[model samples]
Target: MAITSANQLELLQTAEAVAREKMIDPALVIEAMEESLARAAKSRYGAEMDIRVSIDRKTGRATFTRVRTVVEDDELENYQAEMTVDQAKQYLDDPKVGDTFVEEVPPVEMGRIAAQSAKQVILQKVREAERDKQYEEFKDRVGQILNVQVKREEYGNVIVDLNPGEGVLRRNEKIGRESYRPNDRIRVYIKDVRREQRGPQVFLSRTAPEFMAELFKMEVPEIYEGIIEIKAVARDPGSRAKIAVISYDGSIDPVGACVGMRGSRVQAVVNELQGEKIDIIPWNEDMPTFLVNALQPAEVSKVVFDEDAERIEVVVPEDQLSLAIGRRGQNVRLASQLTGLDIDILTEEEESKRRQAEFEERTKLFMDTLDLDEFFAQLLVSEGFTNLEEVAYVELDELLVIDGVDEDTANELQARARDYLEAQNAKAMERARELGVQDSLVEFEGLTPQMIEALAEDGVKSLEDFATCADWELAGGWTTVDGERTKDDGVLEPFDVSLEEAQNMIMTARVMLGWVDPAELEADAEEDAELEEEQEA
Candidate 1:
């Protein structure tokens, strides 16, 4: 609507106020005000009229115009939006396509409804601008700590008021036993800023390990200045945590630097976390050495690793077992989390007993499964035979490499293993058939009879079901429980197909059943190129 000079200045002042309140740029607010006023002007003029408006950012002066584009007679489909060359000559100007013409449209007074409509538009624009600002500002601050005041709690989630916008410290991300009242000051790490249907969602976290690290950065000047680096951290949250730090300057001790004078530095962070204990350990590139450092005050006598299983066996002195394992296994558990290894703690005596037990168990297993005598079974167990799968999966050439097993004996041993496996598979196939296993699944060469039965039990009994099975599901992969790798001993050796083999088998099944076109699979290759093109556009 048309506005007097004083009214125009008042509108600009209102925009500035909204911008200040919303923490957005004032220019954007002025632009929104201009747009709102232009829409109101359109209501006063005709809805079909081509209307445009501009506001002076510096002087708060408003301008309005009824605009038209000069186009060829054939292009003048909308008479109100476009003007012809012959008609432009009547106004004494050069008539050409793509030329914009503007005529001053006197500003019109607004009714109550029009004023209310303008107010709604301004509010919407303010919200959109605020979302944009929050995204732009907080996106870069991801993983950084910011102190905020608790505004209120919603549905068990704490809402904290931040500089630009509010952030939600989600229920699960909060440390245990920590509670807050309104206006309580707390620091949180900016975990994420994501756009949602409602608006930008600012996610804050106090329980992330990175949050503890960030607090160390703030407290330790060496870390903030890049003289020291925080390599890794693991937290039991609100109870205990471990941090590994490395110093570039060899003269400086990373742990001592983090601990500060009389532990003041770490104690500051602990105070903020409600007395969470921090273990500052020196980091080492050698993972085993780092694990030793992480499990400080508890000596490790010996360390054995099973790389395939991603498990570590640590042997400590009999007296150190309780200390190394901590109260209820907290020490070993945190060490495992820090080093990214699954650790099993044992005393030296316990480890020796376990070894002897394993040896006896393996000797008996070889004697029974491979039809070997006590002498041969002892030889096989002495050479590290843990189970029947080891004998079944060992190469014939590798078997020749073992001591005391001559050519004839190795051949006989392998033949016995093969015969036993065949007999087992025959029985498994019979059971799978009794369970109504699909022929398509049974016909697949990659799956063993045991796997076929397992698949059938899981209801993957059709070719389509087999095709839909993920590679990890079809073959096998490790899962974790509380960050420790679960002992998934199924699907061992040749019968356990690689992911590529699983994918190939699924595609072969799909092709044989005429379920998918070969061309459709080929089209998946162009998907990345198409996505890049769409992103560029």
Candidate 2:
């Protein structure tokens, strides 16, 4: 194959120009041009014929060929593209099966219609190549900050020209107080890149917590150099934000570093955020101290934490309640987000009232359920026995460790607690049966009759329903109602079962129903955990 036309070199120059403009391999451009020529040649040579074209990248020569495979007469699949030895001898002196034979044909001129069609093919190929490049370039850059120019705005969405291609900064992703015009420059974080039918969607975000952190990293040199690190960030978009920072070096004050000289650095970030208020709090490994810092300006009277529940009760003065809670509960909400804990804010008076109510309820529950006097009930309450189950299943030594409680008394107390529990369970089982609770669930030790009744009322009538419940739905956990993750005031009340107990109950029900493989329960989990610890050691 050779170039006969004078303009053959022009093809090579055009391919190079398009490759450079599109930032693609020149070989790819030549290949796409080759395909476009092949499609054009087919129209002249009849669409049913196997016509191919090759353009030499160096010589700019275009060659056209009608291709055929040498095969036995009986094995020919297509009459036009396959030939026997009788026909093959005309092209090749000796041709074997599976060998291709090409016969050169005169190059067809690119007519008006063919030129138009070829232009479309080349454009489509270039667009696809560009999309591939965009995907490759932006895929790894996701979650990183980038400076972009607002090229266009479509229906409130800012379409920014990225380093390579166009990206979408959606309306919801923009800060609430910030609006953009065409050619307006802004800093955006690459949230995600999705391969869609149209092209790679490079989604940008201006309101992400990471975006703010990135801005701080730009404004503050200490964070960028690794002397200080951002531990966590929580944002209310353009209104207010909280960032927890820690210093790796003992001498560097992380908060002061972020605040900069006379609040200049922070004010720069705030200006970029459209006047968003920022709280740069020092992060501490001590959760109580960190939480106290997270809720700044409003002093915390006390922080009562339940390590088991990972919940915190913050008590503030009556007048400071509103400040601690912020406007529309923003302060506590941001603090919760920063700390990753479910925070309950109350006044000191409310804390006292709640404590008294809880104590009285527990004491009364013990006095009424067990055949104990008020003094004994109060004694059990003071001994940190919250419920009858603790009394029933606690080790005898634990009960004996309480002062004035002998082994005989502990035994008697345990017996009475068990009896009371058994009686309550019997009543619950009856109630659950009346409520149509499954018998398999009834046999599970961890589930109380009241819980069974609740499950039954909530359409969980079968073991499968109970098994498929999400850990959050089964046990209480965080809920996200809107775009943000905030607690749903009331979706489903949680079952008061410890995760281990819930696991045991679900395993028991499934095992009883033959839903789980029994072979999987070969090792005691505790023993397995200990073995894992030993292996780690």
Candidate 3:
């Protein structure tokens, strides 16, 4: 068949018809042809093959010629099998074994099968070349957005006609509320590029988290230039998103800078996201404060971090629970992902009950630590002293100056108070137990000796505190994790379960059914009490 530009165009039209009949693109056929020709040339002439061919504009006549290396070779068996001396003379000087020569090989049509085979080879080559070209074009644009025209829909997915080629914009990547028609212009972020048997495939997205980041870069100069840094982002895609941003320059307010004058900067991003709500939060090094800020519009009361579990528990108001959790848990989910914390949400009522129970548990512990022999802690209920906080916060001198107390008595009382406070602390461990806190101990930090005693004073005490206390307040009050104390220092290593979990096991063992009776325990306690009283007496 004749090959030329005019004929090629005619062939293109015919190929398009063929492609359409076969449910394929004519461009795909052309790519395959180019690839097949290159491969055939490479194989036939070796690295010395530099054959050049072009189709005539009107005739469709594809002229093929051979370009050969000027070298000497005798038996060119496998390479250029038919090289006449006259043909070899044109390209070479002194001919010998292993010498090279060039000769024009006429384009021969063996039969229809051979023609078909050549067409198939060309098609295959086109596909490979297209894949390589597409991979190169899109790999660098992985996280960037490109404007594309909607070409066609297949199996609910839209194929976008990009300038260089085409790409698939999966259904999931389509904005939830947006609809598209053929030829509609839309901006899509390049999610991935894959090389396939047919050609290079482009994957596009409209809902990825980086979509917002990319839009921000386009809208805000500060972002592209790296003046303002987007520390992290949490997105619900088509609904709402929270981004933590910080600026290296003190003069620039990161949030305001991103927001632009009257919300211009963020508005551009929101428009790209199809009216999605955007919340720009100021990033903080302080974990607690940052966590609270991240769960915005929900009014977080506190955040508790469990170092060993690498988790955070957020306390919010009862009404704000759903808001904090968001629809289908999007809020907390995004926040957890952004902060790299496993977040657990708690309501005010639950936190309140837990706080009360924790209070009672600590009081019982304080009572246990008192020197039952030399002294005893008398509950000062009449004076409104319910927990240790009332006691710890009160002036030591003032406490000693109370009626029935002198300076000597006061000093002794202070020492006793301190000891009682220390012993009440569940955080304290003997040298053997000093290794770690229990693995099941989620509220592993923030329980101060004073807080423990205070809780005890409130009639709150025991493992019940462990069971009921909200992680936030527990984390806020004191610390249980060991090692370095500063934020600048990296996180402490997790406490080993073998040593730490023993404390929880002991509590479990004591709570089982085979335990002694309270009355029997009271009688035994009375005997102990008698001994203590005698020692004091």
TM-score of 3: 0.53
Whichever of 2 and 3 has more TM-score, that candidate is 2
Position 318, candidate 2: lDDT: 96
What is the lDDT of every predicted structure here? 0.83, 0.84, 0.64
Least accurate 10 contiguous residues by lDDT in model 2: 486-495
**Tens digits of per-residue lDDT for model 2 on 1-537?**
223678799889988999999899888888888888898888888887798989877788899999998899889778788888778888888878878898899888888888889888888899899999999999999889888898988988889998688999999999994677888888899999999999999999989999999999999999989999999999999899999999999999999999989999999999988899999999999898889999997998998887646788888899888888999999999999899887888998998999889999999999888888888888889889999899999999988877789999999999998998788778866876877777766665666676777777777866777876655555555555663555422113454555455566667767777877767775566679999999999
> Which candidate number would show the highest TM-score if scored against the true structure?
2
Candidate 2 ranges with C-alpha deviation above 4 Å: 1-3, 69-77, 82-99, 307-310, 392-414, 430-473, 483-495, 504-537
Better of 1 and 3 by lDDT: 1
Candidate closest to the true structure, highest lDDT: 2
Q: Model 3 segments beyond 4 Å from truth?
A: 1-109, 317-323, 358-537
Q: What lDDT score is found at residue 270 in candidate 2?
A: 96
In model 1, which runs have C-alpha deviations exceeding 4 angstroms?
A: 5-24, 46-50, 56-61, 67-104, 148-161, 168-186, 195-201, 285-289, 316-318, 346-357, 386-468, 479-537
Whole-model lDDT for model 1 versus the true structure? 0.83
The count of backbone overlaps in candidate 3 is 43
- For residues 1-537, could you state the per-residue lDDT of candidate 1 as single tens digits? 448887777877888788787778888888777788888988887787788888887777788898888899888887887888888787647777887788887777878888899888888888898888878888888999988999999887999998667899999899896778999999999999998878889999999999999999999999999999999899988999989999999999998999999989999999988788888888988776788888887999988876544568888999888888887788888998898888888899999999898888888888888877878898887777666667777877777777777889787887788789889889888887888887877887667787787777777776778877676666566788765576433332236466567778778888778988988887985897899999999
Residue 1, candidate 1: Cα error in Å is 8.0
